[model samples]
Each structure stands twice: as C-alpha cells, then as structure tokens.
Target: MMEAANCSLRVNRLLLDPKFESYKLSLDPLPCYGVELDTAVAEVKLRDDQYTLDHMRAYGMYNYLHCNPWSPDSVFYVDQLGRVMNINVTLDTALGKPIEVFRFPSDLSSCDRRLCSSIHFTSQDWVTLSDGTGTLYLIHILRNDQSAAGKWELKFNQELGDPFIVLHSVLYTRSEVQIIDALILSIEKDELDVEGSGFHVSLEWISITCSPNDDKYEILKRRNLHGKSVPHYAAIEPDGNSLTIISYKPFRFIADETNQPEEERMEEEEKKGKEVRELFKMTFALPEGAGRAVLSSGSVEVTLAKREVGNMWAEVIAGDTQGEFVADPAQSAAIAERLMHLTSEDLNPNPDCEKPPCNAQELEECDMSLEDSTTLCRFDGNTTKATHVVNLGGNQFLFSLEAAPELMPCFSLRHDVDALMWQPVSSQGDNLWDHAATFNALGYVQASKQDKKFFTCAPNFSYAALCECVRRIFIYRQPTPVSTVLYNRKEGRHVGQVAKQQVASLESSDPILGFQASNERLFVLTTKKLFVIRVNTAG
Candidate 1:
C-alpha cells in the first residue's frame, strides 16, 4: 500500500487532505488526482539479448491482454524467440518458463520467427504478420488449441501491400469460416509526389473477388490528382465493385472572428470565391475489400467507406414525397409488410417528454441555446453519436500513443500554454464520423515534462503508465467519481491526473521498452528484465 500525499488548494479557504486515491469533482475545487508511489516491485528478468525493446514495442501495439479469449485469467504475450508466454497474475507471482509454440519445417522458411514482427489482424488468433521486408504471412496461432499445427501453424504465405501496415477486424464469410473482405492500404510512399513545388495525392481501392485462404490476392494503383489539392473533408465510399467520393467546402471557424461584426461577417463572407458548405459528391469506379485483415494503411485526403452518411439536404424538391409510386422491387415486399404492421396501430401520438423551463441564468439559458452543443466526443460515441457523453462508455477505455509525451491533451493552459491532440483515421469512421464537426477536447492527459515517453493505460484503467527515461515509469492514477460536468474540472476526462514531479515512479536498470496492463498487475519490459508493478487503488 502507498501513503497519501498532501495537496494544497485555495478553495473556500479549507484545508483538506485527499487520500489521492480518488477525486472530488466540481469545477471550482476539483480534487487533484495524485499518484501512488512504488509500493511493490519484483524482478522477473529475461534472457540476455533475446527479448529486447523492439520485440516489446511490437507487442505494445498488439497488446493481447485486452483480447484474452483462450484463457480468461491468463495474460498472453510473445518474446523475441517466438515463444508465447502466458502469465496468470493470480496463480503465479513471477513469469514461468517460455512455452515454445512454433513448429520446424512448417513451410514458412522465409517468414522466420526471429525476423518477423507478429501482429494480430483480428482480436483473436488470425494474424497476418510481416518480416519488415514487405512480405506478409498468414498464420493461425492458438496457445490452447489441439490442432494439427498445434500453437503456431503457417496457413498460407503471400507478398501483399506494405508490411508495416496496421490491420484488424478480420472478415469471415457467414456461410463458412472463409476469410474475405479485408482492406489493405499499402502506401508505397508516405510523402505526396511533388513536382518542383506541387504536391499530388492519390488513393486506389481494389477488392479481391476470391478467398485469401487460397492466397492469390491482387493489387491495383489508382490515378493521382497532380498539382491539385483535394478538398477538405473529402471521403471515398465503396460500393459493390466501385468507389464514391464525397466532399464539401467548409466554413472554418475563423480564428479572428471576434474582431468582425455579425452583419459585416456575413457580408464579407459572401465576397469569398466559393460559397461556404458547398457540397461535392462523386463516384470513383475502383474496387474495394481484402481477404482477412484491414491493415493500418492510407488515410489522408481520401477515405474509403461503405455508403453515403451525414449528408443533410435542406428540402425535398421532387418525387417519393407522396409515396404512391413504388420504384424499387426488392423493397416493395418489405415496405408492404411495414405498412400493414403500422396500419394496425391506433393514432400513435408521440409520448410526452417535456423538460423543465430554463432559469434564464447563463448555465441554464446556455442549455436552451445549445441547439448545436454536444457532450460526447468521437471516442465516447455509443453506437456512433454521443455528447462529452455522460462520461464515456460503461467500461474504462485505455488509449496508447506511440511516443507519449508529444501528444497528451496536457493538463492545463493558464493563458500561456496550449494543449495538443492526435486524431487517428480509425476514429474518423468507427467513432462518430462527424464530417462537419470540428474536433473537440473533452478530457486531457497530463503531459509529462519529457516528451518521448511511451504511454499505455492500465487494463482496468485505474491508472496510466508512461516511460520517458531508462528503467523509470511515471504513474498517473485515474480520478474517481468520473464526472461529465467539466464546469471547472482540473483533470482530463479518462486521463489520469498527475502534476509535474508529484507522481509515483518505478525504477529499473535498462531502458524501459513497453508495457502491458493486466487486472492486478502491469507488465513492464526492459532490455533484459520484465518488471511487474502491482496495481492497487486503495491507500
């Protein structure tokens, strides 16, 4: 157990000693969510020059603790030797011996275990790995399975898109367990083609018509818009065998809008070259889809999606208003069935949901004027669409940054400092997919003084761990009484709070590489040691 630290706050002139275990949330006097120092540490050292930081960093991206399906209680991780290590924190105090799961003469000579970087294409077992030489291999790994290939079996091998691509959401046929419908964006180059001073961008969508189980995937290159800039918010939609792009001229929130009058602002805006919010939607007949893995690839000016969403038409100018003409046949049967069902119900007036009158105060009246306000951010969306959303999901979500310190929303901006945010393309569609909305900052992570820290959250999200220097990790404990009302809150939502130099630090010898959080422990890997930090919230 860790001891409590004293925090001084000038609110209501009261002296309070918060155990630093939880936070008292209210904007005016938001409790400082402090840290718990090193109460316990045990050395579970590793073999020399075997499982280095590179292997740990690779495992950090594909942290399997959150996707433990084979063994509920045991945590699974891999080492440089291709050994699948399983650790049950409850049953064992330290990590046991390595369990060799690969087989020799497995027909995967080129994709050797030591040379390849293993990444899970799906949350479960299907892994499409790379040897970092632009070669991908399909492997089915199951530690507890009793199959022909046993734990590590190379199913099929093929040379696909860029090897250093991120992939997930494995697609399987509903009829049979066949892998199909995955999108691989193998970007040949990270930079746009520049002719002297011009930058050209291109996005190509190609769909595989057959199963990857046979392993004959194809690739096609799309055309590039040379010397032309893609419009803001432009996105591509994929149909059966083609692609569609939707874009618009945005009305960006001008930074110096405060200096212009409302009437003058409207008049000046009209003088611009193009009208604000100009809609542009078109189709590109490029194919889409992959076999199993949706590799982390291209997401720049172009976006690939299924259908058109978030398109708002002001008025319906033409037919289908009366609903007399049934144009499409596949929907006629479904439409008739729906009309028959609704025809039976009595005049179904909407239920009463009257909210109380606003008190005319700024807080209360602002609620009335919130015609376009939201509480949920993209990361907080339920199905997709939510406000600062009544304090994010039911379960605590952990967020990891490649090199931590550069990106935490940061603690505060006392008029002099600014905060930063890193938005990935995955959140663009999977989360809210708000094309028109500007990015919002609901919560924040207290940025460490050092900027190169590797960040990963605890399994339970009870706290967060960051490694900046060698052998030392700073701990940020999650504030308690998670509140949605940011009306003066000090800490960031979902981000654990820790002031500069006022948090717990775990020491080690070698450079700290990566971290994997489990229920009761956080597995900290160094150059040659695997240190376990026990997580406890109570003081």
Candidate 2:
C-alpha cells in the first residue's frame, strides 16, 4: 500500500441529484474533462473542477445506459419501450431531445429485470444494444448537411443474433463485441447423498463482428462453456486476437424453499447439505493469436504473418534469403555511424586527421547511402542476443537485440508465457515466402517500399504519456486488506503504498459499484451517491 505521506486524497465535490440515483460515471471526450453521470432516467455532466454542473436532461426511463468511454458526450441507452436512444451532448436541445435511432418489435417483451440490459457504443457513431432476450441491434449514427441542418440521421438498423441469457457484454473494439451467457444444468446423484441435486452453471462466449458486407453484422465465433468456474468479466488485448476472462462465484443450486415456511427452511437447507460457496476471482486467457504479427529486418524488408494450425507460416516467394535476420532501424543507424568513423580513422591515422580525415567526404557519402539501403551485418548467435521485449501499449513490441548492429520491430502477437517464446518465421520450407509474399498474404495490398518509413525503432510519444500518467496515480493496499483503495487508474501504481482516511469513510457510507479515472481525477459511484476526488501524489 502507498504511504499516506506519499499522496493525499480529498473529496472535490458531492454530485448529488435527489431526483434520481446515479449508477454509472465516465469521463467526457477530448477537450472536455467533465464527467458524465447515468441515472437511468437522465444524463448529467459535471465539469472538470467538480464544483459546477455542466448539463443535465431527462431522456426517460432506461433499462440500460452506457456512455462511450472515448466520447462521453455521446450516450446510448435502451428505453423502457425497447427503443435505442442516442443523445449527442454537442447538439442543442432545441434541435431535438434524445433521438430514437432504433426500436425492437412491439410484441417482444422488455428485457429481464433480473439481468442488466446491455448498451455499448462500439465507436463514436456505432452502437450495439441488447434487449436481453438474445436480440442485438446495431445502429449507425450519421451526420450530413444534405439531410438537415444540425440534425443527425440514423442509418438502416441491422439486427443480429439469437443470443443466450447475456450475463455481461463488452465492446472489444469498433468491430467486435463479446457476450458471456450462462447455461444452468441440473444434476442428480444417489438418493442417500443430501447434496445429490444441485445446479451447475456453464458459461458460453459469443463474439459479434461487423460483416465484410457493408451495413451488416454477423456472429463470428462462439465458445461453449468448458470450465468449472463462471466467467464474470472479460477484456480483449489491443491486438484484438487474445481474450482474458476473470472468473468467480462457483455456485450450485439448492432446493427452492419458497413453498416451505421461511423460518423452518432456513436451518433445514444448511443442515441438509447446502453449503455456501465463497466468491473468488481468477483470470485465464482464451483462443490466441487473432491478429497478424510483423517483424522488420532494419532494411526496407519486413515479414508479416499470422498463426495457423499452431505454427507460424508465411507465403513463399522465389530467391528469398532464408535464416537471415537484420538489425532494427535505430541499431542499424548506430552501426553505420560507427563503421563510417572507423573507416575514416583507418584511412588517416595521423593526428591531423582529428581536424579533417582524408576520407571524411567518402565516409559521409557512405553514411548517407546506408540510410536508404540495407547494410548486411552478420549476427554471430553467441554475441547477438534478443535481450528484452518492450511492450509498446496497444500490443506492439520492440525486440531489443543486444550486441547486434540493428534493431528489430515485432508487431502484435499472443505472447507465450510458459516458454517466453516468439514464433520465428519459417526459415526453410516450401511454404516460406519472401517479405513481399508475406505482406501480400496479410492483406497489405497497398504496402510498398515507402511503408518502411513508418516503422519506428523507438516507442511513440503516446506511450510515454501513458507511463507518466500511470506513475502519477500510486494505488496501494495492505496485505490481506478488506477495502479496495481507489487510485487514479491512469496515474497510479499496481501495488498499494498509501492509505487515505477518506477511502474508509467512503466504504462505510455505501457499497461502491464502480469507478472511472482520468490522469488527475477519479469519479466513484456507490449505490446512492457519486464522488469526485482530486488525487495528489508525491513527486
């Protein structure tokens, strides 16, 4: 846990709207640091300072509400009438209120009140809404002056699925959404066993993706429940290939005792072998490598491939050098500079060479040419080593090969944790293709010589910003702590190093449903109230 001295936490403001209970909170999009509140019947916005209320409007009773994480200014929800509504905060109320973009059939019943309704904004203008009865509707919001001034138009509504009872749903990206469904089974054992009859839950995953055909969507994949535990949450890797599921709550059904007197059935169920199951959280990965991986060999050459049949393969091309690796761009530049300096020194071994080497101009020309050409630098396996795999947020990686003259860049792939291995491109096989064939097979139809200029030997600036934000929020919890400490998600560290008195006070007040964090601020929502806190951390 973080030490109290290292950071200070104080309540910035209480966002209390007595008219309705706030159940969800998210940050507004870029240029607006305000926070958005979802109260089922209305949407509210609080300014960055937390003292001022920016906007509030009642849409109606909604069974489900979801604010776009990337653009909180846009809110999507499912109304009581089974209609999907979109409220663009940027639009004026006089132009229109919440727009009814799509609606389900009148005969279809409202979603099961027991299960939470699903509404996810997959992108800025695309949304997926679920009525909880296995039906999903995709709505695309469009804006064009030809239609109307200041009026956004909704395109055709595309309906997909016959989903199971959706326990939870998440928009993996603009193109994919994953759904988890529960399958309950009843098992019978010997009559003498008191716990003979109980319920077993199996979970299933349904993935929905936009079809290649414009304006259409389809179920791309379905995974049946095969584990002993139930999955409660899931997140897709940035590459959109791997999935991680958090499982908990191993449960078994007991006799429905509503028919018997409550007082008589309570103790009877416990004594008759109905044991309570404790809740635990465990995470596991699923079907790997859905995205393509790219490896660059410092020159204008690069290889791109995908996993197939548990092996890494690339398209074959003629006269392609095999088993040859090249240095990354940065390393290649460094090598060229050193080689030029040595050649200059060797040609002019006199003290006067310090001022002007006899071959200085020749060396300079060689350096310039090397920048656009490939310098074959032999890699002695003993000296050249793949030292570290640097994770550039978004699943990109830089393979740091020490002692090698060049650097290598590797794109996104499912990391093998067991062996800490990366799939090497096929060196010698009939299927092995040259760089050109590999790129073409991966659908890089437009890839050309100029594309190599886009590859960087160093991490991007956005990655540095992410690291700085994470360093600012230092969240820490004590060993075996009971309460979860709230830290700025983007700024804090993983381990607990600090404790705030306000955290205990907040927990005592109500059960925390969830939280949203920006670089400097955090918004926490409980069952009854919402809190905006300013997180201050030591340098």
Candidate 3:
C-alpha cells in the first residue's frame, strides 16, 4: 500500500499547505510507499531500549555479538572492559536484571582498543576474551565464583603456557577448545625485502572436566609444537581441512615454556636471539554434525572425522563463494580411508601434514590471510587508496572510498547515498590490478564508516547493511530509503503508510559502537542503551 509524503496534508483539504513541507526529512513525495521505504526509515518500535555499559571506548567495537545460549531471541555483549552481559530485547521489558559477568583481571583499562576481541561460543557455557598484549582468558560463565586469591575472581586458573598469547577463530566441542593463533599479526613485504613476510596458523587445545559432587572444575592445558614433515610446495591440502606448507629450511622447536624465573626466561630469549620461523601446523576440525573431530597444535594439525566421508562440501563457512568444492570421485576413497585411519589414532596423522614453512616468505602466490592492507595494495593496484580490504566472495574485494577526516567535508569526496564498491582480482600471482575494471556498485548503506566496522554485506548479495554515522539505521530495498519514506505530521515518521523493511532506530544520544543483523532482527548496542528490534529483511 502507498501513502502521502507529508502527514499534515489532510484527506479533506483541497489546497496544499506549503508550510507543512519543512517538517518532513525529504521535500519530495515517494515513488512507492510502505515496504519499499522500510530499509531507510529510522523510527521503529522495539522490545527494549536502555542498558548500560560502563567502560566503553570510542574507538572500541562492542557490536560483535553472539546468541544467548538460554535465550534464543536475545544476545550477549562483551564491552571493552571485558564485562559480559546477557541482553534480552524480545519483550517490552526484560523481567530479569539480566546477569552481567566481569573478568578476573583487575585492569583491562590499560589494554589497547584495537587488539580486543571476545566470543561466547554457541551451546558452550564458557566465554573467551583477548587483550592487546596477546593474552587470553577463558571464563566458565556459569560457574561465576571467586578464587582463593582475592585478586582473581576465578575459581581456578589453568595457566595455558602463556596467558599472554593472542588467539583467533577458536573452534569448540563438548570437552575441548581448539584455539588457533597466528604467528604473525600483520605481514608487510617489499621488493627491497625480497624474502617477504607472511604468517602461519598455530593451535593449542584445552580440556575441561566438571564434578557434580563438589563445585569443582578441572582444566587441562596442552601446548605441543611438533612437525614431522615439511613439503615446500604444499600450501593447502586437497581435502580442504588441513593446511600444509613446504619449506626446505628447518628450525628447532621450543620444547619447554613453564614457570621459569623472569631472569632465566630473559636470558634464554637473549641466547636464542633473533626471530626464528619454526615449522608450525594448525588444524581445524570438520564442522559439528560430521562426527567427533579435534584440531590440535603446538605446531598445529586439524583432522576431520565423518561417518559419510565420500560426499564433499561446496565451501568452508556457508555462503563463502571463493571456490567451488569439486570432489574427484577417484580420490574420495583414498581420502575417506585416510580420514578413517586418522579417527582411530588420537590426532596423529601418518606424517602430520601440519606446520607452515620456517620463513613466511611473501607467498606472492599465497592467499594466506598473512597479508595486510600494504600487501593488498601490492597485489591489487585498484586498491591503492582503499581504506579497508574486505574479501566478500572468492576473488572479489569490496572497498569504500574514505580519505582523511578533513577531506570528508569536501563535496567531491562525499558519496550521495554512501555505498561500497566491489572489484574482482586474480588469485595468488597476479599484480595486474591497475588494469582491473569495476564490477558493480553495492547497494547504498545509511552509515558512513565515519570509519569503523559498523557495516557488513550479506553473502548472497541480496543487500548491503550498515548503521549510519549517528543514531539511525535506514534499511532500503529501493533506489534509496531516504526519499521513498512517508512523513505524517500526526503519526510522526510513518504517518500515511506502513513501510516494512527491517527498521530500527536508537533513541539514545550516545554513539553506537557496534551491531549485527541476524534472524530477521537487528541488535544494536551503544554506550548507554541496547535495542533489539524485530525486523523483516525478507527480500
């Protein structure tokens, strides 16, 4: 159904009250009404509004959220100070105070905002968070209790090798956590530095057990970095589960890193000297439903266990269109047999296909996430002034045009609707990026990165979603959400007709830190409020 653009224009009135136009966000009338403008309009009735987070940082990201294990419609938010809270916006008012959990560390206050990350695993009762120093903390959220030492608000600490080692993309199971970490945070190489820099994935696993008789929790930390073979050419294994990098030069593995005195540790590091690239391997288990699989690393090794192994999957994470999974019928049996044999042994392969080469040379031919913005510029010329590098699909990269803050005020630099652009690049070895042409413009986003990660694109390319720079998120499915919406003076924004795209608006004066769209609902978190809006992005 369509409606009028101005609400003050009554049905009985014959003459137009030209004065009523200024009340509307747009001066012109809409070409279409209701649902067409849903994506753009900001005012929306939601289940919740105010929720407080004390130490949120301006440069911080609290938008990264996860599903609440007990509450399907709600989510958990971990703020910059490492405090976790369960927020349920599915109701007019969440009856419960909503338990908020804090970390044992006395001070996450000094941590750098960039290196902060947290995850509340699905179906798991634990929460893991990371700090700038590469340190990690795994908290049994359910067993929120105090330890013997009054300082740490933990029941017990497992001392996982180094509490300071940073981790990424950790995989979880019933009794264990496969924590994968990167040896190098960012890689930058140039022609002058021929042996170019790269990064390798390493893993460590933690086992936990709980007792019913006493409120006791047991945690086992295993850190073993071992690699039996290194193939100089094996970038990634065929099954797609394991990563094998072959390098001729080999280095000694670090055997022990226990409770050595600080001075002794310093002396050991002094003697061992400059950075040595040890062959390391990190393996990730096949997804949950396949079977029982575990990914282990000191040097890492990931093994997949499947009951029906012959059938292959099209992609790794669903909707990732990087490559097609074309399984060769001929090798299916061999792979299945090998996988079956691996199942019998406890994470041991014939020759552990784990570990990357010693030196992470600029595998100019390698798509290892080891590359940073600099490396991306080296590989793709079109990405020269690109502020961010996002690999949405296989070889396609999406970028937004953003210059210095001073340049933003210039009309030439500002985008009318503010949208992202996509460009496809040749894989591995191609530096012909300058010769590359534009693909197509992504749909408009309401928010200007003002620059932060408040934007994310749907995999299927149906639409792109982002929160505007201020307090509004406009969801548009039309040429634009701005002009297509109706403004009735009486009913406020939605005066004449009902616009229906997934719509949510923050009522708070505080700036939004982060938000995520999942399951037809929008979850937004700001410094002083949390809003869960029931939306319909059903294009």
Candidate 4:
C-alpha cells in the first residue's frame, strides 16, 4: 500500500495467492476465476489484516467462465453444444454440479454461434436470455419453491420483429426479492433493408413493469424515438421512477397530438414526414412526479446524489456539442401552425378574463396575424443555455445553465398557485464548483473549494473538507475558516461546525472510475483496482 501526507484515510494493497496469481479477478465478491493446470478453477481470497482463502473449486473439463452479477454463488458459460449452463460455486462434491438453464430450439439450430447464446442476470431475481433470433425471455428465480430447490421460471418473452437488435438492457429492483421495472434499448433497420447493412437506424425504447404483489410482467410503454443514433449508456434513478439515456446523436421528442381531430391530424401527417426537423438535446419528462429525465449525447457521465432538501439531484459536468438545425421552409411553416394551434387551445378557457371567450381557431388566426415569428418562447443570453436540468420531485426543478465558458448559472423552478416561478440560487455564484460531487449525510470532498471539505452530522451540524485528485487517491484537509457563523436570525441558533484535524492522505495508483458512499463506508472503483475506505467522523 502507498501512503500520502495529510490524508485521513488508510490504504491497503491486496494481492492474490501465488497459486492463483495469473487468474483474472471479479471484484463483485472478491472472487478469481481462470484456468489452472489444464482445469477450470474458481477461488475467493481476501486479505485485510491477515490472509484468508474463502473458497476454491476446480472443474475437470467444463469451464465456468463468466461471473453472475445477481449472485456470488453462481457462474455461467456456454457449453460445446451451444447450451447455456449455470454452475453453483458452493457445490463441493467430487462430481461437481452444473444445471442446464436454456437451449436453442431445433428450428434455430443453424443460428449464428457468435450471438446465439448470451445470458445476463440483470437483477437478483430476473435473468434475460436471448435466442439470437430477435426473441428475449425474462427468467424469474423462484426461491421459495418447495418442489424444486432452485427452479427458474419463465415470466414472459418479447419478440422485436425482424432486423431489430437489443443494444442494452437494465433491470431495476427494489430489494433482493422484488423487481420493480426494466428498460430495453434497441435499434431497428430503416429503409436500408439488408439485414445487417444499414446506415439509417431507428431507435426504440421499451419499458417493462412488474408490481411487488403480482407475478406477471407487463409492457408499460414502448416508443420509437424520432432521432436516429446509437446510444452509449443508460441509467435509472435510485427510486426507479425515471430513466436517462446517453446517445451519440441529438435527442428529439415526438410531439403530442392527442387533441387534434382525426381528419386534421391525418391531413397534417400527410404534409409532414415521419421525422421531425427541429433537433434538441434528448430529455424525457415522465408524467409521474413530473420528473425530467435528460438523455445527453456523447460519452459524458452524469453523477447522482441525494440532497438534504428531501429530493434527489443529478449533476453533469461535461462539454457539450452544438446541435444542428435542419428544418426547411415548408417544415418550419407546418411546425408553426401546430405550435399556434396548441397555444390557442391553452388560452381558450381563461377564468381570470372577463371579456367574451373566443374559439381556438379564431384565437389562433388572430394571434398568427399579429406576429411573423412562429416560436412561442426563446432564450437569448448565455445564462439561458442549460447544461443540465434536474427534477427535484413534485414539479420542482433545478437548472444549471452556462453563463461563461467556465461559469454556471443556477436557478430553481416551481409552481406558485396557477403560475410558474423561476428563482435564481444565490448560494451558487460564478465560482467554479464541482458539479459532479454531491453532499449527503455521509460527506463530500471537493477540490475547487478553499476549505476543501464538507460533511453532514446528526443534530444538524455541517463541516467542510476538500481534496485534490493528484493520483487516483485524494489528498484532503479541513481548513480553518476566518469566521464561522452559527446563528440565523429567522431560524434561531444552529448547530456549531466541527473542527477536523489533519490526517494522512488516501492513495491509489489507477484512475478513479466511480465513487459511492453509504452510511458507513465509501467504495471507490478505479480502472484497475477497488478501494473500500472507512468513513470516520471527528467528535
């Protein structure tokens, strides 16, 4: 282990035993799996204060290649005959144990070997298997079944008609036993009909939901997005209420046209093509809780953290790519008509107005005559260019806009009675704050702040801490403030700030990949290693 000065944390380097030094390690539960002496071997060894080997087993011929994310005791691999098998690591019998989970049908016997048999355990209870023929099955593990000890039951299957490929699948679970929802991202072939050869891609989003008391899984929603591009990564909020998708192309939304008459809609549809011309950053606002889910383009990663204000917050601190506008004059005119129709409908019933009410069509014609511009609203200044917008639950939102190349403008939005309200956050000025790191009950370390640190404590006291990511590890310190205020005129006296001492720095060699904090520990994952740091509070 390497040590640094003035850091409060300790570092420990873990090495595998000599016999299993060459094996690749799966850090899920600290297990290592690889070939040894021409035999497949799986072992778990962890050392903190002393060295200890937890479990070791060897398979004579059959290889237990991949580890399952759902459970630590299970591993799977495709057999020679294209059959996917799951092996239990705890089965210590001389014969060893393997169970046949799935096999392709005889009709699909000549399916492509490379893609025919791929299985993923998305959650503790849900597993997805594909037949390489555009069919996917969701398997739910019945743990309480008495007839068969570890039985796997098929819940449902979805067929994404010909020429559609499943790019990513994510399962959201509330606990070890309950799966709340699942999201599947797929790409379908467009005009270019040759099965695998196509430059035009139509992206689709499929959402599946299963209640806690029900055993059936149902498709809640499915939408063929307007924009065509490849998505890089996807994430679901902690509450399982929203999903954010990251793609390589600009995001577009399908306009809501439910209120239009069938004839008018059909006539307008004939004039407008299947795709929309105006391009915007991809973001989705689900009806429930009025949550805004932003799907940004590119490889930039977004970080989510809980706030003390009783809502969840997400911060994205990456560079943005300018989107293109490709609308022709005819397309612009058509869009303008639609926008005018929508605005007229919104003002048809005004309870505050005492004048005679006008019909939607009349109002639309009158409004169109007064203005040449079709756009209903527009933002002009640099502060109006939003980089990130977070849904703070209950129709409340926070937007981080770009003020300068390096400065950010912060504001909050909420509904005040019948009208909407936008208020700027005074605490966040033009200073360079870390948008990726968040504060919670545990603590947060930012390198940009002068004091360099902050932490939350019981009875309402908050302290500050700051650190720099020189290497992978953080060298942090708690600075002495020139003046500390403990009282608020309106809220009365507050809890006093805690004074932290100088300690040794936390050190690592690899680049930090991700960080997560719980009530007691901080888990940091680097490109090459994993570091589990203990959280200690000063009294």
Candidate 1 vs. true structure, TM-score: 0.40
Off by over 4 Å in 2: 1-67, 72-114, 123-125, 141-197, 207-214, 237-241, 248-514, 520-539
Which structure among the candidates has the greatest TM-score? 1
How much does candidate 4 score in TM-score?
A: 0.34
Q: Model 1's lDDT to the true fold?
A: 0.33
TM-scores for candidates 1 onward, in order: 0.40, 0.31, 0.36, 0.34
User: C-alpha displacement of 86 in model 2, angstroms?
Assistant: 6.8
Q: How accurate locally, in lDDT, is each candidate? A: 0.33, 0.30, 0.34, 0.35
Better of 1 and 2 by TM-score: 1
TM-score of model 3 vs. true structure: 0.36
Tell me the lDDT of candidate 4.
Answer: 0.35
- Count residue pairs with overlapping backbones in model 1: 13
- Tens-place lDDT per residue, model 4, 1-539, is 01111111111112111111111111222111211111112211111311111101011111123334334334455454545555443322221345566554434445342222345455556666655456766777767754222567777777765323343345654454334333343333345445633433344445666553566677765544432344323333323443333333333323335632334455567756643343223333345434234423323332333223222223323454443334458867977987984576564577787756755565422122211211111111122121332222222221221111111222112221111112222134322122221122111122122322211111111211222232322322222232566554565655343333323234554333233222222333333333344333323
Output the lDDT of residue 236, model 4: 33
Better of 1 and 3 by TM-score: 1
Q: Between 1 and 4, whose TM-score is larger? A: 1
1-539: candidate 3 lDDT, tens digit per residue: 01111111011122112222221122222121111111111111111211111112111233445544234345555554455555444343332343455543645555332333444331234444544334545454453444111121333334333222222222233434232212212111123434522221222333344432354665533332222211111111111122212222221122345633334466668755854332322244455545443433222353454433234555555887663344457677878987884465554445656576645574423233321311121111121112222221212122221111111100010012223332222242322111111111222222223444455433222333567646766443312234455666764655332213343456665566556544445565555555555443434
On the 0 to 100 scale, the lDDT of residue 456 in model 3 is: 43
Better of 3 and 4 by TM-score: 3
